[model samples]
Target: MAKKLSIIVVLLALMGATAAAQDAKAVLQAAAKGMGTEALKCITYSGTGGYVGIVGQGYSPGDDWPKVELASFSRTINFDARTMREEQVRRQGNYPSRGGGGIPIQGEQRLINLISGNYAWNLQGTNVNPQPAAAATRQLEIWLDPHGFLKGAMAAKDLVGFERYEGGPSREGGFGEKRNILAYTMGKFRIQGSINNQNEVVRVQTFVPTPLLGDTVEEKTYGGYKQFGGVKFPTNFHHHTNWDHEERPQGYFGVRDGGHNSFGITIANVQPNMCGEAVTVPAAVQNTAVPPVRVESQKLADGVFYLTGGSHHSVAVEFSDFVTVVEAPLDEARSLAVIGEVKKLIPNKRIKYVVNTHHHFDHSGGLRTYVHEGAIPVAHRDLVPYYYYAVMDLAPRTLEPDRLSLYPPDEFQETFVLEGVQNDKYTISDGTRIMDLHLVEGNPHAVGMLMVHLPKEKLLIEADLFNPPAASAPLPTTASAANTSLYNNVQRLKLNVAQIVPIHGRVFPWADFVKIAGSGKTN
Candidate 1:
């Protein structure tokens, strides 16, 4: 009788533990549902706020880029889960209204409204009325509940319970693929929550993750809630992605203009069909440069030389004590070639500052090599912390983790000055000669773009806005709006530009830009 009783007690204890584990599993499932299941269904909200983006800087050791900041942006979204229809509208500082004068009619159309739906076309660019991918919505489901059971992957399961008794500390999270010298660390944090009888999660006390600027991280927090719709939503979203995490589908490069980069959806409305259609391939763009290229250098001004051929254009400047290269084109191999050429031109002079034009992946991707070479990157002011904390520090460190690994950690032995002035006019001068860094104002290229101004040569070093027409090509018969915008900027800044040297074109006189803008003519 005594042995039997002992056995029964042991069995009861095991049963209790099993029950607790099952409850935890249910709570986790609810959490996952909150992320995708519920959030995806909720719609029709308007929000007005500001956002920031971090770009370029560098990927190697000790290199950093600048951040782009924007204020006064608003959005409105409308969603119908039962019919799976969404609509969105967006308005920016002084930009004209988008989306057929307000709310779109017919079919599901909103931002991030991922229902297995097809694309529906409408007014203004591409209007996707019904997203075709919606057919697979049920199959492509994602779980967001923190404690929810994942469909597969034991690693994910383990992560959910890494600190069941008490919340674990927050570490840097990976965004996309990790790369060399890109800082990627989050602030330390912990969480506490309770599960209801129905396996629903409620009252989650989230310790905020800190956003690092250059080398500093700011701590933040969020408190989630269980709403009546059988879903949990982070009633408060507090953590900021290195880039602005707004659901809107448009991006502005420089200044506000009447042109709208509407990918078809707004805040309160979502056009999931428009999601995939947002990226359009510029049809007219054709690369005619030679292959397995070689480099050709030309002296544009005193201390400033334009290195062309070998696939890309790079401007090399002889600074007071070192040589500064404006842009590092292409990947490590290309950067290595650039380094070799710069060394040959000015023997023993170190390549100092690599001033990136913007943060697009293509333009600033090669920054890792500079970081490894111990060169500091001078970028826009807003991107400092993101470079130091989110990109370089915590990024993946193997398999071509970039040249910066040649050095040690915290050995960022350089200065990355990100400018903050939003004026149309700015200059970096060495007293005798002044180099103006003009914001492209209303450009759709990249935000906070810097155009190098050479006053003595009356030259402008720019990228993406306009390229030189081929030597054999005839002058343009029709004007391009982009060309007109570039001209407007020149007039706005009052830049006495004579020569226009694009990063991807043969040399051309500013008169050419004027002709293209003034009368749809190109030479």
Candidate 2:
């Protein structure tokens, strides 16, 4: 009887899969025909709209990714070559230099991001920087497009379809039209998209792993379709990332305001097969391979080590019983490398705490790895909403299933492990080694920025405040807000600092910082 039951289940699943495939093909065919993308091989779209927001550069935790004026934006997607090139000309306009990532552009900044097959690179003037890390997501952007979604789904595996009601019911809660949902597994990414009653591919989304949100939500919505040649193109395009990092109110997908509203554009022109000649993979980028995670340790003081290798750095402070790591930057591989280095530096001691400098994604990305190792994250109280509840199993992390999610420690009770720093000052001491966490006052870069100070060592561990340029590199022309803020805060806190161990650059004496940061405030 048991054998018969198992056989019945297998047959039922097979039948269901066949039915799903049949339904998926019919739905996709209709959407392709309705959108007039049945014969499209490539496309070029251009427009002017500033609403391109940089993730992790928002004014506050809940604020939308900071926006800037894109004087012009254009993208070319080649289905045949499986390549994408996006060009944007951004200007400072009204945006200020508050957050990181060169926010306040004095003049026009031209950017060209190119991805072909397995390689990704960026072009700025005559420079070519290999961005191998960005290849996966950049490639995904191609399929996120409306017509590309159909083409990708047609070749995808395990394709299925279902009817999705926007609200409670087909007509309940002011819902407009019925949507046909199609899902498939393409490569390592599982894509799910919806077609509206008008047969337009209105939404395409997938789960991407993120340091802050774990299984972060990445979605693209399109509307305002207009005919360009035989193909119908969307005049309006909007992108949302980390959409579910916080709870969102129930509603059909619409233009709403939140940190997740990453980028938007109003298309004015669309040309088919105008993607131009195939983008040649530059030799420089082609020769570059994904670099391995390397942690080069420089002893800052007794039991204090500066972990630097790549663009970012972390400091591992050793204590009698355990260790504390400051500024876990980048992602899993980086944090893992730093952790291994910490173990080698201070063997047989547990990593007790990870001091987060700020809530920026780049700085806080590796906190989860430390949390997985049973280290409590210490951040500004304002970030409790962003980090405290974020580590929990709020959403399914099936996309990548971080080690923490897959195998938490036996003592882990699934409780929030974040330790919030309050009242501008949080101290960690064993009556011998003292580390002071002071809130950076009047800095527009981040609201809850904290700079770690070891009084006895006269060492200040800071990030974003001042990333000292290489000794060989030329000095900067303009003084930055972050540098000025650091100069003021060092004085405001009245802490003596001899050597500044920066999380971004090599260790430099405070005198060098004085030259770059200078004195006084910015208007």
Candidate 3:
């Protein structure tokens, strides 16, 4: 009798497993039918929305991400072909410029971005340039779309699985509703979608690689579903970064600005199966490889060198025994190139210190690379904790391993913060060569920003404060408050300035700055 009962229990367990599998499949099918995913081979959507240049804007340590205005935007995607074309007309508002110079206020700026299969390129008016990394990212976004995700899962049913998920509390309040989740793996990315009671995909979550963060989380939400021409799509779309990394290491999450990197779009209309044009790669772009690192060093003084190869620039000052480099801009590739140039320019002298201007991603992204080279980073005292906890301490080089990740932690030294308490001034000198790092007071661009001053050379090097207008460009009718503040600081300090070496634009005389900033005198 006992053996018979055991056999009955085993049969019941098998039945439960079978039922779970069936439930998963049913949920996916329901979602497909509700969203009209089966008929969604291609789609073209046009909408007007704004986008913030989050990476380009500087944040004050733990402050929320800054905003940049995007006047008009539109996108078209072909799911079957795995292609996308995005167009935007950007504008500059009251927001302060961070690094890549201030946007032109005279006219609207147009940009066109395209991704077809494995190819990605950008077109600005008449210029076309290849962007391989951006193309890869765009491809992932296409597959992760609500309708696209459903169709892809059906095709790869062998690798798809579903489970009941308790999504915790709803945004309104109380215990949130339960959801059926469809999860799958595509290449290096892991994707999951949550289906609600209406059999519609409410949200999709995935992971993407980043230079600062190892594997960053990206979440997209869909709502206001409407059927257009026999295809159902979400009218309201919102996407966020670091959405699921709340409890993870600070480095893994990157930004804690309450989804400041997030953006939304309200769809005006959708055309189904309309996209079919084949994207042709330009000859110039197809033949163009990753440009070799080339640093054109201009000797500013006896021991000072200005390193310029790309749009961004860096300064290397040779000390009595070691060297101090200012502003490690861009990513690891750019930083590695700059470092190589520094080594060649000043042989045998180790890069002992790297002075960071602010916490903007573009300016500070290469700090890790500098740290890997055994250089101490000096920045605002408040930023040290964020950099240490959110950047250095949580080091897992799994995604794109750098020199610091490959080596033991013991090999690198600690970062240095310029304590603003005992005067907002930090200096590095060897009696003969002196460099004063002072906080740019009252500047609207960034917090705890440091301007490098060579008293001996009467030269001041700064970033984003005042990028001189091009020789052919006309002077603006009004000056930015940030530029005005920079002029005031220079006069307040009473430092004899001869030349102003801006990180973004060409070096200009100090007189040019005063002329543009209105005499550095109060109105």
Candidate 4:
């Protein structure tokens, strides 16, 4: 009797799932037909718009990504072949060049991005720059297109549908239209999209894994449907790369545009069914694989080790009882590797603090790993709110769970501590070993920029402020505004500096920096 009851429960659950799948299939078919994409297999669209220059490099913590005008933006999508190619010409005209995102564009920047099947690569003047890490995100993007969304949803056998109020955050205060939401899983990615009463795909959302935000939200909202040729297309669209927590999707978008907004466009032209044009996968891209995280450390002082081996670097300072790692860049893999190296270098000491120089995504990506290992984050005072809401508490990281995500403390404050930058300077000392953190002022880089000073060792560590030229590379005739500011600040603080250690490049003498920036010009 007990076995018969268990079998009955299983059969009932299967029936419910099948019913949901049938409903979802009908909804997808309606949307596809209404959007005039039932027979569409390929699409190409071109437009003019505004774009974010740098994804995570803002002037201040929590600030919106820097903006640039897209003189022209074009994309060609081959849904049957699972391919996409986009060309963007960006211009920095009239936009304030305050934050870093390839700011101060001299004239125009041309960018070509391509994706075919599971492979992705960028075209740099005919050179194939393989981006193995970008493959998943690029592939998922293909499904975000309105037509692509329907095709993907229809293909999934487990697709489900439900009704949701398309409103803002709250139930009482929020106001939005009612819409049908269809969702399904494609490989590792789970996709969901909203279809309005008109049977148009108004929004498409999906989660992608990242080092910093974990499972980051990527979304696109489409509107202003207009017929071009054989099918309908959206004339306007807003895209979000790192969407704010869905809890408050409407309120905290970002600065000027919205918190997570990356770019927007108003379509000028649309062309469908370009059958013969197919993006060929380059041999290099097709064979590319994500390289393993490698950390090579060089001893600079008795208890200090410089962690290198990648484009970014971190400094490990060992205290008698604890260890502090400065600059957790890239993602969990990078931070985990650096942590392993630090432990091998200095055994039996717990990591106590991770000093984040700024809030740039690349630099902050790996910070959560150290936090999971029980280290406090030392960041600029202005970064607390952003870190709490966007990075630590509110944002979801479940796509590819990191340590912190897998074992989060019951309460946010129980293990998460953002500590640093009091009165623009904070110092870490175990009475004998001391390191000073000073906030950089009047720099074009980041408003919460920090420079670490090892007073006793007479070594200054910084990021982006002054990336020293390679040993054989030539120094500039005149210092850039960023370099000049670093020099002036060094003089103003009267720091006895012997060597300048850059997070991006090898260490160089203070004298070599002076040769180009010693003019003492104030920025």
How many residue pairs collide in each prediction?
71, 1, 0, 5
TM-score per candidate, in order? Answer: 0.46, 0.91, 0.85, 0.89
RMSD of each: 13.2, 3.6, 4.6, 3.9
Poorly placed runs, candidate 1 (over 4 Å): 1-294, 382-389, 413-425, 520-523
Q: Model 4: residues >4 Å from true position, as ranges?
A: 1-20, 167-174, 244-258, 394-396, 408-412, 519-523
Model 4 lDDT tens row, 408-495:
7667556467885879899999999999999888888887889999998998999888887788989766776778878888888989
How far residue 29's Cα lies from its native spot in candidate 4, in Å, is 1.7
lDDT of each: 0.46, 0.83, 0.74, 0.83
Question: Mind giving the per-residue lDDT tens digits that candidate 2 earns over 16-120?
Answer: 989888988999999999888778999998999646778876766766777788899999999889999999998877766667666777778889999999999
Instruction: State the local distance difference test value for candidate 4.
Output: 0.83
Give the Cα error of residue 503 in candidate 1, in Å. 0.7
At residue 444, give the lDDT of candidate 2: 75
**CA error at residue 410 for candidate 3, angstroms:** 1.7
Candidate 2: where is the Cα deviation over 4 Å?
A: 1-19, 167-173, 244-258, 394-396, 414-416, 521-523
Tens-digit per-residue lDDT, 1-523, candidate 3: 9999999999999998788667767888898888788777788876666555454353464444455566766777777777788777666666554423343233567778888777788997778988876766778888778887887677664444565645678655778766888887666677888888778888888877666555667888888888899888888887776543332343445533332355567777888887746666787666666677677889999989988877778999999999999998877888998999888888999998999887776788788888878788888775665566566644565556776667745634344332331267888988888899888888877778889899989999998887778878876556677778788899899888999988887788898777778654432
Residue 163 lDDT, candidate 1, scale 0-100: 24
